[model samples]
Every structure is written in structure tokens, then in C-alpha cells.
Target: MPDLYSRRSFIAGVITAGMLSTATGYLLTRRTPVTLTLVTGGDATGGRSLLINLWNRFNPDVRLDVLTVNSSTRDQYDKFAGTRADIYNLDVIHIPRFAARGRIAPIDPPDGITLLAPVQRVSQVEEGSARLWAVPLNTDVGMLYRRITDKRATDAEPEIGRLVADRTQVRQLAAQLATEGSTTDEAFVINVLEQALAQDRTILDERGVVSTSLGQWQRALAPLAAALRDNRIVAVAGEEKTNAAFQERNLRYMRNWPVWFPAIDREERDKKPGTAAIRLGRLPIGVLGGQGLAVAEDTGYRDEAEAVIHFLTGMPAQKLLATYGFAPTASEAYNDPEVKAAMPHLEIVRSAVEDAHPRPMSAGYADFAQVFRQHTYDYLYRGVQLTDGFVEGMQGALR
Candidate 1:
């Protein structure tokens, strides 16, 4: 009886020891927590807020650090090249440039994941190949914001030269608004480069050759030049300022992106009685703008980084984007009942996005854009004539 009891105790002790050892081994070999850095452009507070919230909700184990480099696409590329950021939210037009320079890694999404047709088409980078280089986060297109009392929105394409001729029409519009008791101080605020690009009049051709001629550029800038001289238009630095001017009800028509819808709605809601009202309308043709997530080729946590990308570009995130007033890259998000309710004119925005054209895609796009911007600024703001020599100088700058 004594020997039997001792043997039973020994057996129990050995079993307990084995279990402890197995548990310890499992814990030792477990995966460690991963930290990823995400760098993007634009308003860090608005769009980044949504992303951070979603990340915390979906990826509790991984740590996400976001940085906003609110400068040019060139600035973003420079940061990505110099920093250790695990992921980059780059402009879709810059994907080819980044991929060509080996600044970003090609992505292979999981089997069940898919992007909208237009976004998917843009996501593919390499010529003559189906390799997806980036994950589309959102889509943007130029839009016109006006007073709700304005005439029914039309798709009438403006004649570039006629619209800016002597600023006569713009001055007349301003006078008409004044007569109607509108407090608007400006008739228009034009983004010359964006307008030109949206109209498919890019400085560089598909072959990366300088394609813009003096006559074409003159037609594009003539309207803006007239407005500047006549004080009928205000030349804003970018969209943020344009949106601000429009929000203050100081301008009649403002060209901006659809992302401003939510803020505009909020302004309307918070306005005091008798404040200026605002409305959104489709651009005749919009310049496509948006960002895509690209993983760093040297990231140690490739799988985790990819998972983060999947979550961001996923349905849940896309739905949140739509709700937050961004144009989502997923087709399903557009059809979402709640999203439609939040943005009544989402259908119009969708149509505009469908018709929008992306900027020129080239390895030298940065240089081309710089040249175009300089020439346009001089022509429109500084009253520089669009001469043959000016065109030659622009072409030379492209080289």
C-alpha cells in the first residue's frame, strides 16, 4: 500500500512537470509585437484620424505610427528614401516613378481582396504586366462648389480661351452676384495647373516628351490672366485656401476636391442664420487625385504590413471613408445606403470620378510638374506672355 501511494505521487509530479515545460516552450516561441510607420500627405487630422481609429480597432497587437509630410509628392519620395517608414501613402500617379526607382515594393493582396475596376487599373504599375504595385486607399477628382441657390448644375464644358478673355465674363458674374445681394467678393478662384491637367492637356505626352505648345498654354492661361488683371478672381495657393474662401462665402465658384464635402456640410450645419449657403457640383472633367499604400521592400514585418494595408483598403474602412466625405475606391461603398444618405450628391461625385483623368505618369513627372507650375504661375499671376520662347523654355525645363 505504501509503495503504491508513492508511485502514484511520482506519476502525478512527472505529468505536471511535462505540462509546465510545454507551456513555457510555446510562450518562448510566440510571435513578437510588430511596429509599423505610415507616412502620408494632406490633412493629418481628418483622414489620418479615421485611419488611426480603424487601426486601433482592428489591429490591437500591432503598433501604427503615422506621420504626415504635407508637402509635394517629391517631398514624400525623398522622405521614403531617407527614412525607415514601413509603409507609404503615395499619390497614385507617383507609383510608376517610385516603382521605377525601386522606392516602393510590389504588393500581392490576399486572394479574396479586390479593388474597384478603375482603381485596380490605376494600381497596376509596370507596363505590359499585371503586377499590382500599390493598394488604392481613396480616389479624388476636382469638383466645383457653389451656392445652393445657383442654377442647376450642368456638364457644359467651358471654352478655355473664352472663359478668361479680358475677364469680361467673370466681372459680369461678380456684378450679377452683387446685384442679387450676395456678399461674395470674388467671382472665381482658378487652379490653372489642375484645370489644364483635368482637361487632358498635360505638359508631357505619353512618351514622356514635352507636348504642350505655346498656343495651347496661352489658351489655358488666358482666362486666368484676365481674371488676375481685372481683380475678378483670387489666385489661391492650393485647395485648402480655396476651400476656406468658399467656406467663408467670399467666392462664387471654387474648384476643389470632393473630400471637402463633410467639412462643408458641417459648416452649413454650424452657420448662424443668414450665413452663406454652399453646394457641390461636378466638374466638366476632373483631375484624378488620391493615394495608395505601398509597403517598404525591406520591411521585416512584411505580413503584418500587408495586413494593415488590407484593413485600410477593406470594406469597413472604405465605408468609413465614404461616411467621412472621402471618395472611396471601392464600388460597394458608393452603393452603401448610409454613405449615400450622408452625402446626397455622392452619385454626382461618383460620375465625376469615373470621368476624371489622372496626371501624367512618367519617371520625370516631378520635373515636368515643376516646369508647368512655374510657367503657369508666371503667365497667369505675373502677366508673362505665352510666347514661343516661353514654350521653348518650358520644354527645356522638362528635359
Candidate 2:
């Protein structure tokens, strides 16, 4: 078996090389009569290969050409658009924006099978709105990965804001926070959103606007602000730097998405007799992170694209991906024996996804994210807590 680095390189190469490619799991064959493109982020779980192969075998004439790009990069969104791909595996955060721009067409997914609560909510034009824009391929639930020495017991469930300030629980006060500067620090906003939710704050009112009194808003933000001020969570330069820090042994707790799970699973699977292990646990709330399948607005193959969506989201495809450790949007994946074996902490992931919430839904989500992050940066760092102006700006963006 390839070591971690080689495996990652192979994942990067993906389906781009086509039939003759010698990449580990992904293989290709003669070009089909009608080939549809599936553009998505770097799926580290290697689940896509299983799904793609299954798809090609089952739907022989219509093959999927998988293109995996670094969606986390700030400028990559255009690349996905330029592809004019048939099937876009869209990040949940981008759904509203994509839908509003007419970049992706809204389609009702297959009915009967239940999706995770948050997954169903996020499939809409905006949360609480009826238009269905996408069908979840798989789901993501962010987790806190802690590198423990001496076989430290996993908390399983942690009160994040309290954990940030609790010296006894966090023996070392340093954490590589996802917060760098405000721009594109979606995770920073997500972290605070999770913190605010933990404090029982209703982030948005019935009409879906930032709805908190000045005092209530400040109180909702207090724990995270205090933790940052006290240096319990150290703001790193960027996601890359933060992720690099997660590999080091000095840090106790790290916050990240499930894409990094393969590394932890590899470590546990390949550990030497005397080596230590990293364990994951439930974060207070995971602002739902994952992609859903949407048909590109310009696709000529709408029926075929919709069929592909139904096929991938169907139980068999979902289960294949789940067995490889992609978080299953369908609740039943939790009961699959192979999936359980692949992900030892499936319950932790299950719980995180269960308690998760979507980020404020708006077609102008980028604008909303910017406004929220700007004020949130002020709140977390400068201690400015007025929120009246912040609320006004968010309402403006939402409109």
C-alpha cells in the first residue's frame, strides 16, 4: 500500500488521467457515448472512485469524468464555473449563491428515503424556503481532533466555549484556531457561530435576519471572545498553516473537517506498538460542511444529470461512499457494518451532524459572510460589540 504522501498525490491526479492512468483506485475506460462531468472538491476519503466506478458499471453509456479541484482556494470557484460541467457537487455554503446566480438549477431529489435533518434544510433555495437546489451526495460534520499522549480519555462531548477557557481540561492553552484574518475565514465565523449557538443564541429571527439585541449579542459572543483574548486559541496565518500545525505533536486540540480523517484513521491503522494515537470528539456544533449534487444550469443533459444525482444519492451509492468514510447524508449509513469498521468514531460524527446547523442562508452569502466576519473580527479582537450596525449590514446583504 502507498504511504500517506503518495496516496495524496494519487488522489490529486484523480480521473484527469483517464483510461490508461495507473493511479491506485481510480480507473477509466473508453469514452462513453455521453460523458457527464462531476466537479467537486478533493474528496480525501477515496469514496468518489467507488461511486464513479459503480456508476459507470451500472449506467454503461453515461460515464462520469471526475474533476477534483482545491475548492478551499479563494479563486477556485470560477474554475468550477468555467467547466460548465453537467453535475456540480456543490459545497453547501455555496448553494444559495449558486442558485441565485442561476449557475445551478434547482431540482427536486428523489423522495421517500430520509436525509439528515440539516442536509434536508440546506437543500432548499435558502433555509426555510421551498425550492430544492441540490441533493446531498454525502455530508460533512466538523470535529475536534486532539493529539493525546498517555492515552488521555476522549471527552466524547465537549462544551467548546468552556473547554477553550478550562485550563485543567486543556493542559496546554494553545490551539491553532481557524481564524487568521477575516477574509475567507469562513471557519472563524463558523467557530463563533457554533459558540453562539452553544450559548442558546438564536442567530437569525423568523424572517431570517441577524436578530439579537446589542446586549444579547455581546453575551452570545462572550465565551469565544474571552478565550481568544486570553490566548487559549492562537490565530494562525491561514487554513494551510493551521492544518500544517495539526500534524505536529505539541498541540492538544485541532478543529478541522472530515477530509483530514483519513490521516487519523491511517495513523491508528498503522501505529507501531508503542506509538501514540490521535482521537476525535464532538464539537459543540458543526456548522454543516459538505457538498450536494446540483445540475449545472447550462447542461443539455438535464434528465441524465438528474438521473445521476438520484443514483449517487440513492442508498447503494451513499453506502459505498460511507464505507470509505465519507459522512453519509442518509441516516442509514450509520448502521452499515463496513462503514462502522472504516470509521471507528462514526457515533461522534453522527452526533456532530445531528446537532449541526447551516450558516445563515442567503443568495448573497459571500457578502453576508464578509459582513458577519468583519463585525465578528471586531467583536473577537477589538472588543467592539454593538451588533446594531452589524445586524443592519447583515439585513442589507440578505436583501
Candidate 3:
């Protein structure tokens, strides 16, 4: 009877030991649930959905909710400042101001991620500083995009002079898009500024103050003033109107960013992607445009929020953005096989980002942008003279 009891005890001991071992393994591998919310701009390229869906599918431990806001920056700042949102994806130009106002917190981007140098520089607290307020998610440069039929635009101009010698053709083609209602896509303020940049001149200096002399401003703006006076381009209120006009075939050329490529491609949905109807080329100069990811201070799940941010700016997300025609800020994305195949003008985009001029930084960047537009609006749209007062108005707004 004693031997039988010992055998039974031995069996019980083995069973208990097995259960404890299994429990220990489970405890070590188990993950705590984490939930985070992110705020971003409108997703015209449809990339936000792709990224969100991917994160939810793979990372069972983390749940990320994304919100898209279409309102102006001011309205958004007012509405979401104290909300439950943990991550903020804002324009690169506004990062400095966002950091200054404490709307978004400075971050340390995860290792193994590389951002475009110019883009990184713009998002810094100071030039060449080790500090960074945000991580650049994507980069942009205004390029001339137009639709073509039958033949490639390259073949059409075998000796294409690029923007240097061939811009005249682009202009002439835009002027001749239609006879009675001929118009080229032109968004106000941005058009004037980009054109000035294209001419190798800038009105606002690095400090966000007006720095151009009267003669320099006039020489740089002569083409636009003449175009407006001659009715060569329409002063559309914004990019939406400009793109709408372009889509309706009322424009042979338009001033647009890389983000609009997806919507424009959809217009020719029936055509093969390899022989797409649209052709894109770079301008001699480009105004840097893009968005960055920032964290909100005093947020719950700080670690999880930053983890999601790392994922968003990581290589996988960058590649997905490239597929949608949005310029990915990751320099490696430009070299990824899938990304290169997705965008035939990859070099054009890369060069643009590399050579693009960043907007002047100021704590009051919004006011500066408005002041610039207000001062240049009449001069650009009404063909009025760009006067000394125009410069003063811009200079005053920077302060």
C-alpha cells in the first residue's frame, strides 16, 4: 500500500510540474494590450488606410486609431489640442511653430530610420543641431504634371531640354491647351511663390523676413505678372480648383505636388498603368513640402504612441507611400525595388527633394505665410506693382 501511494504521488508531481512550466512560458511571452490615437491630414493617396490596416493585422498587442482632419491648421489646433489624440502628423513647415506652442512634443526618432537631409534640417530646432522636433514622414516638391496621348512625353521631345530650355514649350503648350477657354492650372500665392523659386530667387530670407530688393523682386516676378496680365493662367483660389481644372482637360500643365498623382491617375483608370496618361517632370527649383510626425505632451501610453510613430515612419510604411505616388521621406524608399517600379519618375522626385528649398522657419510661420500671400496677392493676381510697402508688410508679419 505504501509503494502504491508513492507511485500515485510521483504521477501527481509530474502533472503539477508540467502545468507550472506551461504557465511560466505563457507569462513571459504574453503582451499587455495597448491602444493609441493618431491625428493626420486628409489622405488623398489612400495610404493612411493601408498603413493602419497593416499595423492592426500584425501587432495584436497594439491598437491604433487614426483620424483624418480636413480643416485648416488653426481650426485643427483649436479642436484637437486637449483631445485624446496621442500622435500628430503636421506639415513640416509648421513643426517649429507647433513645438513652440507646445501643441506637439519633440521626439527622438527610432534608430535604423534615415530621413532626407534637407527635410530633417527643416524640422530641427536649429540648423545642424542634434535636436529634432519631429520625424519627417514624406517629402514633396512642386512639379509640372500633364497628361499625354499615344506617345511618351520623353519621345515627343527626344532632345528634351529639361526645365532649362524646354520650359518655353511647356508654357506654350499650356497657353495653347484650348483656344477660346485656354487656361493653365495656377493656385494663388503658392503659384507666385513657386514661380519665384523656379526663377532662382526668394522673397523671404532664412529668418522668415522679406529679403529681396525691389529690382530683384520685379525681375523674378516679371513672367507671372505678364502671364496674369495676358490671361495666360487662371488664379484659382487653391490646389483643389487647380487640380479640378486640370482633370477637366482645361489645363495642359498644372502646379501640383506628388500627392495629387493618385487622384489624377484615377481619371485614366481604364488605361494601363505602364503606359499611364500622365507624365511628370521637375522644375529648375522646387519649394520643399511635406509632413512630419509629432507626439503630444502629457499623453497616456507614451511608449506605445512612439512605437506606432516608429512604425509609421519605418521602411514598410515609406514603401507603401511610394506605391501611392506620395514622395516617401525615407531615402531608402527611393531605392526600394517596388517603389522604383511604382514611380517611373523616381529620379525626378529624388532630385527634387535633394535640391528643394525649405520654407523659412519662424514661430509665427502661419502669420508669415498669410502676410506673404496678402502682400503678393494683388501683385500676382491684379498685375499690380510689387512696391516697397509690399516688402514692409512681409517684414512686419515675421515679427
Candidate 4:
């Protein structure tokens, strides 16, 4: 398997070679049909490849090229922004920012495209406007995964927020678990830093404008820092780390989507039998994120692209994608019995999608996102005051 550096180099070469060949004389001699490159982030590459294969069955003339970008959210944004790629497999939360940059073309509703209403509703650019910068592909919602045998797993199910609220209760539990030989290197894994800022209620103003204000973000980070400090939760950076801890029975609770559960199940089955049994619940009031597909602004075959997008989002394609363990972005798939059976978490994802909030929508919002990640870690893990650390970072980035 290719490592990160090699994959990046390969992707860069693919993009560069295509562009450079067109600039020179290679296009004239090349016998292959015109290729449409779709740049995407996230781990649905397998599902996307399947979708591309299905698309080729209809339009064999146009080849679809899939480029997998960075796995890290921040790195992925930088990679997408640095290159002038054709299509972006964007996270729904990131679409507003991409639109604000005018970096991509919008899918006009007047064109009579076959976009799913729920997909559109979740990613609507403006009310009654069909012009969308992106379309929903696979759903992903943040979920809280706790140990099945945790103290909170008594007769009554406890609300996750209430459990994480009181510092003493959390500390006492951690101490008891430690004394009882259940101590682990990492107690809890939470995406505290990322979710806090992006999921802030105050990030959006009354008129639906995105705010990157330091004060607003400072307030957001407070609860997160308190959780980490008092709850003894170790901050985790990515899905893999969170999954690893959960599978090892090291994590009492962690933030993740439905995708991680199955992978963890398999890993635990192979490594530790009992660890396979884990509990899932809704994200505590603030975690939301999902992925979507978008037509490249530069594709020559708009009509074909429209048809392909439509077909991929339709019932058949959604069912296939869901079978591969992806969250269906289409309502048809979300409502399907088979799809729901395959992914029981669809209900949770559905609620998250309907109530989901997009991240900051500024043209320079990617930059703002970076600041959110940086200052959040600084204040939450490094013991910097939420206000002082966050305010300085935001003022510098926004300026």
C-alpha cells in the first residue's frame, strides 16, 4: 500500500500530467476518451469506485478518474485548495465555505436535475434555489460510543451530556475503574476541539451568516476543556485512533460515526471477543458532519455528468452504496428496510442530517477551520485559557 507521501505525489502527478499533456501535444495522440477527474476526501473511495463503475456502464465514452486526497481534514482542505481540480468530494459542512470562495460551479435546480429532495434539503444553498455547490453522497454523523459495561449502563439509559457534565462524578468513576484494574492508557477519546468550535450555536448569526469570531469560539472551547480536564478523556485526532481505543476496550466513550462501529466489531472479533459488544448513542447535542458529491465546475460533459450524478444518487445506486456500509445520503435509501437493516445507525444519522449545521461558510473559512483546530488543542489540552488563546488565534487568521 502507498504511504501518505507517495499517495500525495501520485495524486499530484496525475493532476499535473493531465494538465501538462493537454497544454503540450499529448492529447492529440492519446486514444483514450476524455477523462473527468473527481477529487474527493473521506474514506468512501470503495463506494465511489463502485459508483464510477456503474456510471461507466451508461456513459462509456467519458472516463471517470478518482483521486483520493488527504485523510486529515485540515490537510484535505489544503490539498483541495492548492490544486485547481475538477470535482470536490466535499464534506457537507465544508460546502458552504467552498461556495463562498466561488471555487466551484453550482448545480442549478432550473436545469431539472434529478437530485433527491432530502439530499438537497440537507445541503440547500438557499431556500427555493436549486443552485448547489455540492450534493450529499454518504451520511456521517458524530455518535458517542461508550463501553457497554460502563456504570451509566444501569437499568436506565443516561443522557450523555449529563454524564459528562459533573467533574467529580466523572473523576470518581475514573478512579474506581482505575482501582478495579480497568485502568487504561487513554481514558476517553473525544473530538472535543473540532466539534466545539464548528458546532457552536453562536457561530451563525440571526440572518444565517457564518461567524469566525474569537469570542464566540472562546466560549465554545470552555466546555470542551472542562470535559477533558475533569472527565479524564484523552483527546483523539482521527477515526482510526478513536476506533483503536474502543476496540481495545481502552476508551470508555468516544465520538465517532456509524462507520467506525463495524470496523471496530471486526477488529475486536479478531483481537478480543468481548470487546466486540459496544454501545452507540446520539452525539451530545453538538456533533454533526457528513459527506457529499459535487459536479466539477470544469467538466465539459455537463449533461452526462448530470445523468451520472442522478443515477448514482437514485435508489439502485444508494442501495448498493449502503450495502458497502456507507451511510446513504438519499432519503430513499435512508427509508429502505434493507439499507436500514444494514446500517441501524441511519436513524441517528437522519436526525443529525435534518438538524445538522454546516461549518463556517466564508471564502476563507478553510483558514478559519485551521484556527479552530489549532486554538482548540492549545486551550483544551495545553492548558491555555480559552479566551486568550482563541481570541489571539482568530484575530490573527481573520486579519
Candidate 5:
């Protein structure tokens, strides 16, 4: 059977290209130009850089009036739910929730819109349905970076054998090796130990929700607390601070978004080339993510809008993006020799993408992430009991 994306693309090409652009289509094409209102985060210039490039390259005859909204994530979601913006940069999961609410326009899969292939599989929209509500732009995935120096130290035959067999044993040896104090100076670091805990199978229910089973929580959370208590982790600061710490050599193995890792490696390498040790790995069983593109339901020039989207996601653009530090969503990019050379660790990210678990799709998902971050921070940093914090947040979302 053709995959969902291939099938949808065939259907869309046949219907949209043949039907929408018939002789009658010229009637609509010649009218006053329609402008697309794009609301995204960051400065308008930088925010729409990708789309603007596509617009310039494709020149769909439709004027794109990009509106880069400078607002907090929470503020943006509030505005979107209030039916304030026509198009916004949103997480993949939130698309379904908003679609279900009818606040945003339907993102019908058929016709001209270019939705990300991966997203189509997870989207709640029906197969062969022309109306699509959301699409992914750039996907983010979690990565495990370990200290190359530490990895080297443990390469001796005796240590290598032990490290490969069990992750727990590896971490324990790392913690001990880190304590030995060497002039080389490195430490194995990860996000607050709780992140590792969350990755364990015991913590998630069959539906992929956080499991409420008390036994599961204990089994998972215990090692995490111990890792934290043992100081194997650098304090779980937010992303900015965490990156800063890594650059400063305060961390060894850390969990970070793949997009930022190369930049981090570069910055460190420039200052201490071949000195600041670095290695990347697929996230261990958790912390997976990916990004894709979608067209707006409210885009007046649907054909033009899709033209721009398709050009952006097309093979050429995707290949270009891979050069600029982005992990390509298209599967083919992984095997490209040039892409592999530029990003040697691309396969690790590919594996991460393959296993990527999207965030929750509830209408309340954005709000849920806000609460979830708090729960993680409170337990990891603020000393709040893990169970109480997680339960409170989940219950609030359920409510």
C-alpha cells in the first residue's frame, strides 16, 4: 500500500492541479492579488525567512504579508484559541486540538496544501479527506551528548566491556571517573535526572500518557533521584542556561535539541578546538521529536499558498536546510553523502526521528506543556514531590 503521504500527494495533484486550475481558474488568478497573513514567533524578518525565501523562489503571484508576533508561547496560544490569528507556528500536536475546536481553518489534505508526511500519519484528520487543519515546520528532537574525554578514558578493554552491557553501569562508572579529578576536566551530564526517569517504560501507560501506577512511578523515579542526589547531573537549568553550562565545560553528557547541538559544538570548538569533548547519541527511549509543514485553512490563495509550502518542503529545499543545521524530515536526506559529511551524526537524529513520539494533541496541549514544564522544574529543581506535582498537572489538564 502506498504510504499516507504518497497516496495523499497523488490525490492532491490529480484533484488540485487538474480541477482547480482549469480554464475557469484563470478567472480567479487575474484578480487583485491576495495577501497571506502569517503570524509566527521571533522578529518578522527572521521568523519568515524560510517562507520568504520560498516566496521569492516560487513567486506564486500572491503577496505574503508576514506578521511576526512577538509574544510568549502562552500568549500566542491564547490568541490562537481566541481565533485571533489565521496562521501561526505551532507544535505538531497542538494542530489537532485547534482543528477539533473549529477555531482555526481546516487543513484539508487534498487540494494544494503540502502537509508534512509524518504528521499525516498522526493527524486525526481522515484519510482521503481534502480538509487538513495543521502541518509541521521544523521538528525538534532530544539528543544524548556524552563527554568524548570520558568516553576515551573508558575505552580500555576492561571498562569498554562493562560500559556496553548496561547503561546504569556506564553511568555509575562515569560518575566515579568524573570524581577522580583529571586535568583534562570533563563530567557526564544530562538533563535533570528526572528526564531520564521519564524515559523508562514504567512511567508511560499503554496510551502513551504518563502512567499513574504507583509502582511504575517508584521504579522510574528512584534511580533519577539517586542520579540527582549523587550529583551526576549538572543542575537542570532551562535550555539557555543548560547550553551555557555545557559550553563552559560544566557538563559532559547532556540532553539538548538537535538543532542547537551543532551550534553548541561549534561555539565550544572555536574556543577550545579539539579540547572540549563532544559526542551525540539518539535519545534513550524518550525525548524524541520531529517537525513538518502545513498550510493555513484561511489562506485566501490556497493554490499559491500550497505552491510555496511544497517548494519549501520539496527535495531541493530540504537538502538545503540540512546544510544549515536542520535535520531533514524527509527520509532520503539521511542517506545523502554530503549531508552525512556535514552532519556525520545525522543517522542518530534519523533514528530519533523514526521513533519520535509527538507531544499530546489535546486542545489543552499547549496549556498542558506549560504545566508539564512546571512539574518537571518543580520536582527537579524546586524540590516538590514528583508524584504530587505530576498528578496535579495531569488532573488539571483532564479537567
Candidate 6:
């Protein structure tokens, strides 16, 4: 039986090799069909499957092999640097670094391609001069999730001024809810990192300068400190934990991404009698997040790769992505009746995306982020004050 199993494996290997050889022969002879390799991040949404199906139907002669890389953006860029993949789905934050390193090719979008104005701005990364480094795929932005109640949430979108006012209101609301028999310890939740980024107070500026001054850091973190002292805001570890706490109804208001709306809605629907109400609203500005399609510089099938990118970012594909739970980057996708019905607060999301700020576009952004995270965490959770010494340390880390 062992010998038979080994013999079967050998036969299968030979058959596979023969099939590959025949395909290579056909490719060499025909010169018409193109097989493009795409390396991208994991598909939490069903967008990738929809894209492949649409591509197969629209361009029958083009064969696409997608390799999903579920890792950090730095790791994704490293893998692209070492591989021969024709296209990449890169995190937009890393576009400047990848473009600077020449790991990805600059894009020249086809005529008639319409990108949401804000998405287009973020997709173009400048090395020496401004160039379209990637085509916008789906987009994401930070948002405020809260329990619906008798009092309407702020009608105005979230902005720095609004957030500041909201902080005070949240404290007042916590006191009011406590008086009204609420026993929860937390009234609001926000990530220190999100607040800092939303207010354009990153460790570094776009020009690779250390831009987070002592005054700026203090100003940016003052609200967080106030909330922590007042026990009005629960500082969670990250977005996942925050979302989990909110889902358990331990929180009244939370700052999170738009992706969690569907799950929150489901929870709201399943509420019995006195469950915490859930609703979604816009953050005046959030940290911009989403992936972009980039072609590798050395790809042999540049034309075909570009075509795949075009199909992925096109209106139909964007609509499909919206249907699959991703925030679309095309304006038309937000306007689609089906998409609107599915994502009821899409306009709020659109406003947030438009006003969202990208993280500092430095090659050393990972380092910058690390420094900010460490310092911010210490201040928010570990009882460290934003002193002159702390500010000095952060400045050094940014450098």
C-alpha cells in the first residue's frame, strides 16, 4: 500500500508538470492570453471573490492568480520587494515608502476613471514630484458609534472643535446617566491615537520633520487626560477590544471604524427590552484608511496588470465592494440605491472619508507610529503626565 501511494503521488506530479508545460507551450505559441499575478491583503469582505468573477467574465483571455498576504503593511511591502507579482493591494499609508523605494510603480489612471476627490488626493504620493502611486480601492474612516436615545446625537459632523465640545458634553452626559440610574463606569471611549491623528498631530509631518511639539502633544491629549481623570472614557487596548466592549453594551459611545456598523446593527436588532441602543454617526475627521492597487515596477505584464487595477477600481467593482460591506472609494457607489439601503449612514461615512487625514507620509512612519503609540499609551493608561521630559523623549523617538 505504501508503494502504491508513492506511485500515485509520482503520477500526479507528472500530470501536473505536463499540464504546466502544455500551458507554457500554448502561451508561447498564442501570445494572446495573459496570466497576471496579484498579491494583496486578506479579504475580510467578499470583494476579492466578486472581483475575480467579474474579471473572468469581462476579460476571458486574462488569467488572474491572486495571492492573499495577511500581514502588516511593512511585511506586505517586503514581500512585494522580493517577489515577481504583477500587482499589489497595499495599505494606503505605506504608499509613500513603497513609492520612494521604487518597489511599486506610479499609476497613470485611464481616462474616464472617476475617484472620490478625497481618495484621489491620498492615493497620489509624492517622492520628488506628485504622482499617482496607486489607484484607490475601498476606503475607511474613523467614526463615532453610540446608542440611540431620546436626545438626538449631534447633527453637525465630527470636527476638532466638535470633538472638544463632545468631550465636555460626554462628561455631562455621564453625570446625567449616572443620576438617572445608569451603573456603567464608562460613558465614552476613544483611542488616544485616533484623537491625535484626527487632529493632525502625528509625530512627524509630511515633510519628514518631527512635528509633534510639546504644546501640540499636550493640546492633543488634554481631552483624553480629562476623560481618564473623570472616569468618563474607557481607554481600551485597541479597536477590537473597544468594539467588543461596545457590543457587550458596556459603553455608551465609542470611536471606531465604519466596518463595525453591520455587526452593531445586528446586535441592536436582537436587543430584548432594555438593551443599549446602537447608532452610527460621522466623525468630523478620522484617520484615513484603505488599500490601493499598485503595479510592481518589474512586471512583464504591465498592460494586463493595469487593466486588472482598472477593473477593480471601476464603478461596477466599487459597487460590488460596497455591497460586500466595504466602504467604497468611488462617489457613485455611495449614491447607488442598493448600496444606500444596505449602508444607511453612507453619507456620514462619505463626509468622514472626505475630511479624513492620512498619517505622516514618512519612510520611517512605522518608527513614528511606535513612538506615538508608546508615549500616548503611557499618558492615557499608565498615569504618566505629558511633561517636558516626556515630550523630549517623543521628539527623540520621532527623529
Inter-residue clash pairs, candidate 6: 158-284
Stretches of model 5 off by over 4 angstroms after superposition = 1-30, 43-51, 57-60, 81-86, 106-119, 124-132, 149-199, 205-207, 274-277, 290-294, 370-378, 381-396
Candidate 4 has which clashing residue pairs, if any? none
RMSD of each: 14.9, 6.1, 13.8, 10.3, 9.9, 12.0
lDDT of 4 at 88: 75
Number of the candidate with higher TM-score, 3 or 6 = 3
Better of 2 and 6 by TM-score: 2
Q: Write the per-residue lDDT of candidate 5 for residues 228-345, one digit (tens) a residue.
A: 5555545433455556666565354555666665566655555664544556766444333443344555556666656444544544455555545566666665676655655667
Q: For model 2, what is the alpha-carbon lDDT of residue 40?
A: 83
* Residue range 200-290, candidate 6, lDDT tens digits: 5454333334454678877766765666666655445445566666656445566777776765655565663344345666654566778
Clashing pairs in 3: none
User: In candidate 2, what are the lDDT values of residues 1-399, reduced to their tens digit?
Assistant: 135435444533332232222222223333546889888878655667756666676565677888876655233456677775898888787777778778988887665457777788878765666457989888886677766555565445455667765755433322334464443467666666666766754764322345546677777778777777776675564544655555543566666666566665465446633336656777666677777899999998887788778767766566556545577787776776645544557767888887787776666776777787789888788888755888778777778
Output the number of the lDDT-best candidate.
Answer: 2
Q: Predictions ranked by TM-score, top down?
A: 2, 3, 1, 6, 4, 5
* Consecutive 10-residue window with the lowest summed lDDT within model 1: 174-183
- lDDT per model, in order? 0.59, 0.66, 0.61, 0.52, 0.49, 0.61
The TM-score of candidate 1 is: 0.76
Superposition error at 306 for model 1 (Å) = 1.0
Q: Model 1 scores what on Cα lDDT?
A: 0.59
Listed in order, each prediction's TM-score against the native is 0.76, 0.78, 0.78, 0.71, 0.71, 0.74
Steric overlap count per candidate: 1, 0, 0, 0, 15, 1
By summed lDDT, the worst window of 10 consecutive residues in model 3 runs over 176-185
Please, what are the lDDT tens digits per residue for candidate 1 over residues 22-53? 32321211167666888776553364465565
For model 6, give the 10-residue run with minimal summed lDDT: 174-183
Candidate 5: C-alpha lDDT: 0.49
Model 2 residue 211 lDDT score = 59
**Cα lDDT, model 4, residue 331:** 66
Q: Which of 2 and 4 is the better model by TM-score?
A: 2
